[model samples]
Target: MSIPIWKYALSMLTYFVVLLCITELLRKKYKLANIVWICSLLTFPLWLMGGVSGWFRWAKILSVILPTIVVGFCRIANFEERKGSFWEFFQKGWILWFVYGMLFLNILEATLKDVSLGNYANAACGFLLCATIPFAPKFWEYSKTGEGDLICYTTVGWNFLYTTWNLCFVYGESPNYFASTICILMAAELYPIFKKKPELYIMSRVYTLATHMILRSCFGTMFLKVMDASTWYNASFAKYWGILNFILIIPYLFWYMWQLHTGKAEISFKRGKTNNNVTTLNT
Candidate 1:
């Protein structure tokens, strides 16, 4: 089937604009954020009643819920710097690892899907992508703001890799959804990249992904039909993406490991801007 290029372009732009607007609002308005958070939580029961069950659906729920929890925790704890608060102990001592672990699990979900699909090359790429994550508390430190909290590890390079890897995963696993899904990815990156605030990546991603999933779930038939700009997939296409991801991730992962080994890891690929906790290893 042929995709209408103009229609796809327009749709992508529309989704990007809408997601950015919602994310910006959530970033500024705590009450509104709470409302959206509650609605996102409610989707779980709705999905259950509607008989929605899948790793991806659960992942989507967790994606929204977990980030909302982080924001809420940041708001309640309200500590400036790492004061010796019990909340700080809870957050840094265990919550950090928990968050990172959940993020890793999300990535692993797609990796397993690739493996099950017999796309070994993409599966290996997924594994390598997982390896590159800096799961240490140092890397997962929270940055609190008046609006909410965000993790500091999502640098430009890391965001690029993640967006690419996730895009590849979607294209391989659900090619029909790939077109609309890309708009969400793009929306996640645009504001953060433009503002040079990589820490906002997770927040933006949560808003975009949660909104997309909720809309898609509620209106699957119409949503797919409208966004069905392209619907063709082939083994060769998946293989190409698999190899491409490997090519992009391998050296990047090696460099990250080397930085960890040398005890000089900078979160951003660009020089002169290192994380405050970069002196410590991510082990």
Candidate 2:
């Protein structure tokens, strides 16, 4: 079935508006964001039963992990990045490394799912993406201000790779919902673009993903029912995207490692400025 351009456009527009609002509310206010954080945690089991993962084991894993990501990311945002605080301890402590671990688990879930579905090409890409995780912790810098100033300071290069990898994962897992899901992903990227703050990428992604998951839970057939959107799944479509993800990520991973080895990785501070000489992690 051919989906009209207008339908895609409308879906994109609707998601962009709704998600941007959710992101802003979560980003700009501490109390509200905290409320959402609490609510999301409390509602976790409900989300699992809310038609969230369907029959996909990967989706079930994601249903658990994503909300946890939201909570952890929010807690990182909740702490003031000043001296002698728990937040400071978290940044310095070994526990903070779990942040990266959680991220790796999230990616692995999708990769494993791709493998189970016989998406060999995408699974290969997913494993390659996982390989990049050890190198990833250095790329992100986290901080929060008074009220709601949770900032991740994610760089452009890293976010681009992540967004592309995730898009391919979604394509592999839920091609039938790709059109609508693309809107959510695009909206996530758009938040950073519109805000003119590249650091907002991860923050935007966390909230938008949470919001989309909630919507999916509550209105499982929203896109098809409300928008009259067409849905289809194709192995070739999934395979081609998986192939593309693999091809694109391999060179970038090599380049990333080269940068690290050469002591030239883009390391950003809280303000998002790059320090080329500093090899160790900077927060």
Candidate 3:
């Protein structure tokens, strides 16, 4: 229920805000809404400032900016932004951003004269992802003003899943329910956009608030006294944390499974008269 301290305090809070700034510069990066993009700038100290001092600040900053620059470069040339959603831009163009993080780690190892394949691993993934962007014409298409980037449910689903997975690994056992909650809620908003289920938008907000309250009450009664206020990533709290995160997201996960099932069962969209009959899926 509480925003994940690592996320709020770490890269997500900062990057969400900072990168939201970059969104203003892009053609249309804010999938949630322009208002949500503005709202992302506001964060609480309990979430962002309470973490383990400074970590991934630069990496997150660069992550937001590097891709924006790459995606926006095309726009600056002709005075129009790129032709993809924030996820698509980010989905396809995570190369230099990720590579930069890896390069930083690699350089750190080299600076310490350490030896390991960590740098190699970073380079490998970075190189592979980066290589495809140039050839991916979807990453290059330019649409008219009202015709924004076409949203894809499959792509958005992948992004959402990957984001959750990364958050789990990045936080380890002690996961931040707040960040994860907001992400799920936002992900839920996509259901309305893609599936014409705007009711989920309200449902997501209610669910997020309710979950946070429950977590707060439960944690304060059970584990808050024992939790390290300074850090959530510890053996002492990780199990409960991971459990809470998993429990907190069960609704969201179910939502994902349902969408996937429906996606397979029905054709989201098709041309001609089918367009009138078939639903259109969007990220």
Candidate 4:
């Protein structure tokens, strides 16, 4: 089978351009990070709209255009600042292993292209390894305390959940889940680098809200398209799942909004030294 060369190229270009722009904003107009995120959010619904309508043609076109525009604007704005060293920023105690584990799993799935009971077993074993390994506690601590400039443990936790879902449900060779999984994972991995930077956090939360909103809306729209109102209302699984997700998301959304309003939503590094430094000492 032939690959969709143009689509792949466009996707990569969009990602690079958007990242470049966001990086610029992180340095210059830090306050506008959230706005940048809001911009990124628009792409998701366009994608879903294309998906539910089976407008693969238009979806592919949009997947490229939207990201390009968002990123281009960021680049033109030219807003970045100098900060910590990459190693200083990235070197966390325990969290590295979790990241490594994720990378490992991504590689395995990409190479293997198969998921079976055995694969699930291996994943469980890997998780166990991640938990029991000497480094696990450190990672846990880093995650909990937001050490090494880590912002929220939610970053890794969300990525883990999203990646697990993708592996379980969207493991096809040419995975449609790539955009979502990659976006989330990259954000989580970079959380440490951007930890001391509040602007980045604001942008990230905005991005998260936008992404989730688009996803939920798209799913809702798709449900409407596929099932009549009567059928949807009668479908206990869909009905309850949607309601539960909505209820759960409400508190989270409110909390995030509170943080934004209170200016607590920005990324922050730990002040002074950490007392409970459980991770390996930097060499």
243, model 4: CA deviation in Å? Answer: 34
lDDT of each: 0.68, 0.62, 0.33, 0.37
Query: How does candidate 2 fare on TM-score?
Result: 0.78
Per-residue lDDT tens digits of candidate 1, residues 1-283? 5657787777778877898888788767755675777666666655666545787767766765766656555534443443556546444456666667766777788888888887777778778777777765666554444553555465466678888888877887778788888899999888787767776676677667767777766565554665773466676887888878778878887878787788776534323454443222122
lDDT for position 53 in model 3? 29
Q: On residues 1-283, what C-alpha lDDT tens digit does candidate 4 reach at each position?
A: 2335564456544543455444444534434543554465566666555454434333433343344234323222222212356434333333344433443443344323323322343243233323322223232222212212222233333333333433332223223343433444355345435545331342343343234334434564432232212321223442343334334434544554564468653331222233343334232
Q: How high a TM-score does candidate 4 get?
A: 0.30
lDDT, candidate 4, at 237? 41
Worst 10 residues of 1 by lDDT: 274-283
TM-score of each: 0.82, 0.78, 0.33, 0.30
**What value does the lDDT take at residue 202 in candidate 2?**
61
Tens digit of lDDT per residue, candidate 2, span 1-283?
Answer: 5667787787768877887887887777655665665565556566566555545643644554455454454354335434555445444533335555666666788788788878888788778767765434455444433333334554455566677777777766666666667777888888878987776676677677767766666566666553433355666876887888788888877876886688655543234375332212234
Which structure among the candidates has the greatest lDDT?
Answer: 1
Residue pairs clashing, model 3: 1-212, 3-178, 4-176, 4-178, 4-179, 9-47, 9-48, 268-279
Which residue runs does candidate 4 get wrong by more than 4 Å? 4-10, 23-31, 35-48, 52-119, 122-174, 179-283
User: Which candidate model has the greater lDDT, 2 or 4?
Assistant: 2
